[model samples]
Target: MSHYPVHTMATAPEASQPSLHALQSAFGFIPNIAGAMATSPVLSSSLVGLFGNVHGGSFTEPQIQVLLLTNAVTNEAEWAVAFHTTLALQQGLTPADVDAIRSARLPNDPAFAALSRLARTLIEKRGRLDVTDSAAFLQAGFTEEDLLEVIAVTAASTITNYTANVTKPPLEPAFRDHAWHPA
Candidate 1:
């Protein structure tokens, strides 16, 4: 982390500035994840681009949060787990569901359970989802489009998850209340 050079908008490379500033505006601060990510402008920009694509995809905000939280927990990314925990609640997920995901359990709700299971499987299987995995997601009422969108969300989360692990960014204060550790 000392070697990673956590950057501010002012200190970040020009390629990274827009992404950093956007994250700052979205969360009202540049998360340490983005700061450390700024150390490599190309990678940072790639994350921002992937983020935009995922957010613009077919999933609703709540679904997106579910995917993110699932990825965070699956990957054991403490920083992302904390950040996505807050976001998941804000997106109208119940505390119980969030807790279930945080604890590495499936949510009680059927659809969300399907989503969490699908996301976890996608990651655990390294995106080589078998037909049964996709079938289960479809059985839960998700569309083929939704299935593809899940891949986008997974990719986006993978960027954040990997970046946080590598940079070991300290959690931002606002998200610390929901801080998590992989069980």
Candidate 2:
């Protein structure tokens, strides 16, 4: 069950938008976390924009998915983990791939593993990257520009994960099977 009551898109249409309705129609239900976002259309749109900026910018889909899952695990945010894991798999990642990313390992590709490690480190260390860290990532084929963009993406998702936790957004029925209440 949700920690708080999530206003559905119907009665609380003011809390949502036409896009939100489209989301509901497309996915069969608006995710409770996303529904909580409906309370502030500006926030919802900004969140969507941030997602688009990060997910659609710089990184490949698999890499972005892994980074999202990594952030959730590092923050111990269950909902973020559940939501992104579902989305990644739906986008064609295997269970093993998800597991690898969650563990900060990438069995299939070393470059991705390097990226995931660097991302997790950046998150855990809170932006104080060491010279050695930078060197290792460089050897792994990442440029300074790539690192900067990755930092931006990481920062954006971190905000969303923390916000969702604070709001205790309802986990959609579609995600019930994967919903986790982090202790």
Candidate 3:
């Protein structure tokens, strides 16, 4: 069992309530990871703000999901893996592509393949991307701006991925069908 409480809006600390409510409004429910993060008002609120910026940035929702799912897999965060798996499919990523990401392979679509590879490389290399690392993404048709946005997406997922790893929150029902384990 998780030591961290999966706080609801009512049960969360005062500073965390707004962040919880924002998350609830965005997702139509507060994710268990977010609930756990609420235990730290700073974390919960920081995530809420960064979440907005990341989602509102240049990438499409499906593209964002691709990066998030990749990061979750690389981080080996079970809750985030399941959560992003569900979101990835809902955002129209094919099962084959999602499976590829979950299996630590690139997707069939070149753009998504670029995203997955970049995210995995970023995590594996700890943000130390050499020229060849960056050239591959640029070769895939993504701009320098998209590369930076990928970093933003990675940053957001890191918060959730690390939080989920630490909190060990229960997977929600909606995401349960996509449950994952590190290979």
Kindly list the per-residue Cα lDDT of model 1 for residues 4-80, writing each as its tens digit.
87899889999899899878887788889999999888888898889888888878888889889999999999999
Instruction: List where candidate 2 sits over 4 angstroms from the true fold.
Output: 1-4, 11-29, 104-108, 176-183
Tens digits of lDDT, candidate 2, 1-183? 445446576645574575467557655777766676677677666666676577668788877877777777677677787887787677777788777765656636676677777888898788899999888889988799888888877876776687677777755566666565444
Off by over 4 Å in 1: none
Task: Locate the minimum summed-lDDT window of 10 residues in model 1.
Answer: 1-10
lDDT of 3 by residue, 1-183 (tens): 889999998899999999999999999999999999999999998999889999999999999999999999999999999999998999999999999999999999999999999999999999999999999999999999999888888888999999999999999998889999997
Question: lDDT for each of the candidates?
Answer: 0.90, 0.72, 0.94
Candidate 2 positional error at 37, Å: 2.1
Top candidate when judged by TM-score against the true structure? 3
